[model samples]
Each structure stands twice: as C-alpha cells, then as structure tokens.
Target chain A: MDAKETVMNVLKDITGTDLSDKMDENLFETGLIDSMATVELLLNLQDELGIDVPISEFDRQEWDTPNKIINKVESM
Target chain B: MVNIQPYGTPEYFALIILFLLPIIIGLFNGRRFVNYETLFSLVFLVLTFGGSKWQQGVALIGYVIFEVITVGVYARYRAKQNNTAPFVWAVIIAIIPLVIVKVTPAIEGGKQSLIGFLGISYLTFKSVQMIMEMRDGSIKEFHPLAFIRFILFFPTISSGPIDRYRRFHKDYVQIPDKDRYLKMVDKAVFYIFQGFLYKFVLGYLFGKLLLPIVAHQAMLQRSAFFHTGLSLPLLGYMYTYSMYLFFDFAGYSLFAVAISYLMGIETPMNFNKPFASHNIKDFWNRWHMTLSFWFRDFIFMRFTFFIMKHRWIKNRIRVSQLAYLVNFLVMGFWHGVTWFYIVYGLFHAAAMIINDIWLRFKKKHKGIPHNRFTEGFAIFLTFNVICFSFLIFSGFLNTLWFK
Candidate 1:
C-alpha cells in the first residue's frame, strides 16, 4: 500500500468507521475519533508509519480532516 | 487567580508596557524574542510578584526556581543517557506545597492563600513534564534557557492547559517563516484582548450578575417556578462559563503562542471548539485540552502501564473499567487537590465508563444503530452531564451527594 493507503488504513483502525473516500470528514466533529483516541492515533501514526510527527503538526486544521492529516503526513 | 493590576497608578502602566513591548518588538523584528519571553517572564517574576501581588508573585518565583533546578537535573541526565525524569523531582517539590495547603484542615487556620500559589501549581507541572519528556527523548534537548521560557512563559502563566516540554519545543523550533511569525503575532494580540474580554467581561457578568442573582432567589426561596427559573439561567450562565473558559484559556494560549511566535517558537492550540462536542469523552478531549493531554500522557499513561505491568487491581471488572477509574481520578486530581475535584473527576470517569459500555453494546450491531435525532438527544444529555460535572468541579454547585 502507498502512503495514502497506509493513512486511510490507520484512520479506519482508529475510528472503527469506513473512510475509503470521505477523506475530508472531520474526525472529531463527525465522531470518528475523540480527543482520547487522538493519543492513540498519534502514537500509532508514529509507531506504524515510522514517522515521528512532531506534536506541533497535531493542530486543528491539519489533523481535523482525514485529507488534511494525509496532506500533513505526506508533506512531513 | 489572574493577577490583574488594581485599577490605578503606575502598576497598570507597567503591565501594559510589559505586554506591548513584545507586540512592538514583533512588528519591528522577531529576533531576540526567545530571550525576550524568558527575560520578560523573569521580570514578571520580580516586578509582578513583588508589585501589588507580592505574595502570589513570590510563590510563583519560588516554583519557577525549583522547576528550573529540577529540569537542569533531567538535562544533566540526558547528557549521559535517556530515561530520566527531572519532573519527578519537581513534582515532589510541588507536592510539598500542595500537602501543606490541602492536608491541613481549614478550621485550624491552614494556609490561607490560594492566590500565593496561583501560577505555581500549573507552571511546576509544565516545567517538570517538559523535563521528563526531555529525558524520554520525545523532545529535542532544549537549551536550558529556552526550557525556562517554556515553563514561565506569561500568556498562560495564570491558568494553563499545562503545556508539555515536547510540544513547546516542537512549536518553538519549527516556526515556519517571517510571514508566519507576523500572522501569529496578529492572532496573538487578538487573543490577548480576547482573553481580557472573556475573563473580565463575560466571566464577571456570569459569576457576578447572572449566577449570583439566580443562585440567590433559587436558594433563598423554594418553589418549582423559582427553582426552574434559577436552573435555566444557570444553564445559560454555564454556557457563559463555557465561553468564558474558551475565550479566557484560548485567549491566553494565543498570547503564549504569539509571544512564543515572536520568539520563533510554536505553541499548540489548546482549545478546538470543545463545547461543540457531542459526548462526555469528546468534551474531555476538547476541553482544557492541555490539561487533558498532560493527564493522558503522564498520569493516565504511566499509571495504566504500571497497573497492567504489576497486575495491581485484577477484579474481573474488565481492564476498561480500571482504566476509566484511574484515568478520571488522576484527571480530577490534576484539576486541583480538593475533595470537590476528586468527586468531579470520578463523576466524569463514571459517565465515560458508561458511555464506553454503551458503545460496546452498540458495536454488537452494524453501523448507524441510532437515528440522528436519537444521537442528538444522546449528545445533549452527555453535554449537560459534563457541564454539570464541571459546575460541581468548579465548586459552584454544592449538594449533599456531590461532596
């Protein structure tokens, strides 16, 4: 799987909800993930992806939407 | 207790100059900002502490001094190897003060001043947490000076989201560009004024006017209409408190971010529309977010790890329940050392544990078990439950069971 696939897979595991296409769905707003789950998400993204995302990237805009997070991850 | 310079004289002017100097400096240049944040914070330590509120200032200074020393120990350890926690030492130092004030019964005239220790509790935690992160190698090894600014940075100096050293270090080092710095300064100034509006205006109105009036009529006289009337307004006041909480905290966070921005340091956004949360768990995640993150990372993460590692509480109640109990209790204690705070945390933990059980029960089926209206109803109930817990936590709502 590509980077996007990896991110999507991670999100699915995280939210227990499908996000095959709706990448812009606001994770917190749509009940996909709560703040507590965010800790898991950050940890998983780092451990699974081999990418140590600085917590600074975990801002509202960047991490709010699936697409945004993927965009942030790709850029990093 | 936000040390507002009493409305008069040179002190007010001095405070304005202190805040303004940064803004002016920002517009002109962003160089020397890190130094400024550290220098001004130190100046704030001396002048503001020694100014009108010398007692509180001195206490803040003492904590800052202790936190610095503790962080230094961690920094020294890092020079040799990873896996040390200077914050552990600092927390011990902090607990000394917490015990005297908390353990001593008030009847015998215990430590009479919460104001003295106002900024110390939060700052000490922030300081030590950062040190621990440094030892854990989560954050880049910080210059001892920059770490000091991270601890005593004045924007969130009064009440805080309990910023972590790693987060602060991350933000500090990764300032995007000159334009980004300028944009942050703009946002930061906006937050400073916004902070003023929330704390003084909205908060004062709710606490002084709305809540007081309703609390008076409702408590003094007993009638359903009066009770309902008082409760309804109190709900509105709760929203006010919610807004007050957001603007007050987010405002301060912006100032810190902005100040740190001018210093070319990044700071995390503490609030992310938490009141819009539809669940108990979501609210905790959004609200007082820095505090939430701190408890999760340090207390909850560490405690849960320890419990599981040691097999401490193996009552067949499921590990999830244990997680909830420990998480909430620590979260409550993080808010303050008071009994009210403990109950407040437990209340949240219980509600969340129930919410989790409900989710698991629903998970037995397929997607979309509840209709939108039903979901909305659940969200409403959850929100109120949380608001009520916070009200109790704030020590405003007093009832026999709550204690």
Candidate 2:
C-alpha cells in the first residue's frame, strides 16, 4: 500500500474506526486519538513505513489530521 | 537592601511599571533595548533575593551554576554521539539538588533545606526539559548565557507558567512589530486588572478571609463523625480551598504572563476554565495547563513509549494505566515528599483510570443519552472529585487526622 493508505490503516487500527472520510478532521478533537493513541500511531508508522517522527517534533496542531500525518510522513 | 517579592505589593508593581515604561516605549519605537532589559532584570532579581533572603540567593546562584554545567556537558556530549548512559546520568545529576532539597525537609523533621529556595521545583522542571529535548536532538546547541537568561527571566522566575527554552529564545531574539506590540500591551493591561480581581479580591476573600473561618469551624466539629473530621464545614472548606487555590495560582499566572508580554515574550498561560471541565481528563487539560502538559509530554508519554518499545506490557490499556499512575505519583512527589501529596497523586491516578474506563464504555454504548443536563452533571461530578483530591492535596486531612 501507499504511504497514505498505510497511514489510514494505522489510524483505523488505533481508533477502531475508519477515518478515510474524515481525512482533514482533527483526530484529537474528535477523540479518535489521545496521547496514548498518538504514541501507538507513531510506533505503528515506524514499524510499517520506517517513518520515525520523534515525539518532540510532533506538534499536535501540525499532525492532528490524517492528511497532515500523510504529508508529514511524505515530507520526512 | 530593599526586598521585593514579584507582584507582592502595590509598591513593587508601581516600581516595575515605571521601570518597564522605557522598554514599552522602545518596543513602540521598534527597538528592543536588550542591555537595559538585562539590567532591569538584574535589579529585580537582586530585590527578590537580597537582604533577609540572602541564603536563598546564594542557593539560587549555586543551583544555576550546577545546572548549567550539567546540562551544558550533556549538550556537548550529545553533539558528538547518542548514548543512553550519559543522558540518564545527566538527568539524574540535574535533579540531584532538587531531590536533596525535597528529602531534607521530610527526613529532618520539617526543617527547610539550606539549599532550598523558592521556585526550585520550577527551575528543575526547565532544566530537565532542556536535557530531554537535547537527547531528542531538538535542542541541538547549548548556549549557557541563553540558558541562564531563560532560567532567570525575572517576571516568571519565582513561579512559572513555565516557558520552554526554544520559545523563549525565539521571542528574546526578535522584536514584535508595533501593532502586535500594542495588542500585547492591551492584553497585558487587561491581565493585570483581572489578576487584581482574582488575587487581591477573590483570593483574599476565599484564602485569607473565609478559608480560616471554615477551617476553624471544621476543626470544631472534629469530635463529630467518628472523630474523622468529616463534617459539613469540611466540605465547605474543600470547595473554598479549591476556589482559593485556583484564584491565587491563576491570578499569579496572569501576572507572570502579563509581565512576559510587556517584555515582548509570549509566555504560555497556566489556566483556562478548568472547573467547567466535563471529566477528570478534561480538567487536567484545563488546570495548571503548563505543568500538566509538561508531565503529559515528558513523563506520561515518554513512559508509555518506553514500555511499549520494550514490549513489557502486552495490553495497551494496561500500559496507559500504568503510565497515569507513574505520571501522577511523580507529580505528587514533585509537590513535596509528604503523605497527603502522595495520596493526592494516587487519588488522581485512580480517577484517571476510572475516567478512561467510563470514556471507553460511553464510546461503546451509543444508547447513552447526550445532552446539556448530562454535561452539567459530568462537570459537577468532576469538580467535586477534583476538590476532594485537592483536599487530600491541601494537607488539611493530615492536619485533621495526625496534627
């Protein structure tokens, strides 16, 4: 799968809900991913895509959306 | 040998504002008088640490020198290579003074440590944060001068809304434009007035005036309720003390943030509408936001990451629950090494665990009703739980039972 698809799958796995339709929605605001889930998501991304975003660099505002996550991973 | 507490009296405020006038004008004229600002900060620091508090002043200087060397050495080592052992040592060394300060009182029959000074906990927080960030490679360079200024930025020095190093560095290096500076001035003025209302008026009413009366009344009823000191007056004391804690701390935070603004540094705020929170988790997000956020990022999140990486706990829920317990227990200990503080930590940990369970259940059950009434009830329940925790935190229970 592509990076976007991989990220979407990870988000769905963490939240237990499909978030493909809400790519721009804030995962934190919607209660889909809290601090715990955010770590899980990061770990999953590292395992799946070798995208290692340090916790310090993870600004909640910048990475709050699936699309943003995809973009961040792509940029990295 | 005049001693002045930050925001302690009308005279202090008046003197500070007069000193600040030139910096304010300089900002308006699109110039930052860096040297003068440094001089102003030194004068204030001397005022705070001079005279009767000279011992603390000595301690503060010693503590800052120790931390700068510790963090500086770590930063230099981190520049060449990544090693866990050195980083761990750096963190432990950074906190040794604070540990000594905390443990001295507990072991020595309530005698304050000679090395202990006001805002020691806060300074330690900043130092630890720097070390952690350095390990992460986010703070790549270590400038001792900048670090010292960040640690001693006099406005929030005594108590902080806890400004981050990078954020403070950015503001210190850049001057805000005229329009932005003017808006900041407006906000600063508003915050000063609101602080007056919260600290002088409400804090005085609840903390200085009403708290003692309620506490005395509760003590009078110590013979009631199996001599447990559980009475109606005790409940009143809980709510009153909670209000006092919020107003006094929040008021002080407002002054800190306001002064930082006047200096063209945008310090983070400490409180939002914390009492209106719908759950314990939400309450933490709103209350003493900087400290809680600090704990969340450094302790809770880092602990979860460490355990998960090590595969120590297979269950994710268990991992998070353990993190909460550790996070809050550390926070409790940070407040001081006392029974009430420790219990306060454990109480919050339990509350957080229970809150998570309810959240998960509510998420699963779509049949649960959602409305304003339920939201209100949730807030009411959260508030009471928090106040009870604060009562544990207040050490009044210790006084009632042991003293």
- Tell me candidate 1's TM-score on chain B: 0.79
- Model 2, B18-52: lDDT tens per residue? 99999999988888898999999989888899888
Each candidate's fnat: 0.00, 0.55
lDDT of candidate model 1 versus the reference: 0.62
TM for every model, in the order presented, reads 0.74, 0.99
Model 1 segments beyond 4 Å from truth?
A1-76, B1-19, B26-30, B33-39, B78-110, B113-116, B140-142, B170-176, B222-265, B306-317, B367-372, B399-403
lDDT (tens digit, per residue) of candidate 2 on A1-76: 9998899888988998898889899888777889999899888988999988777877899999999999988887
TM-score of predicted chain B versus true chain B for each candidate = 0.79, 0.99
lDDT of each: 0.62, 0.92
lDDT of 2: 0.92
Error of 1 at B377 (Å): 2.3
lDDT per residue (tens digit) for residues A1-76 in model 1: 6778888888888677788778777877766775445655666677678776533335555688888878877887
Q: Give lDDT tens digits, candidate 1, residues B11-42.
A: 45356556657645653453446555556656
Error of 1 at B383 (Å): 2.8
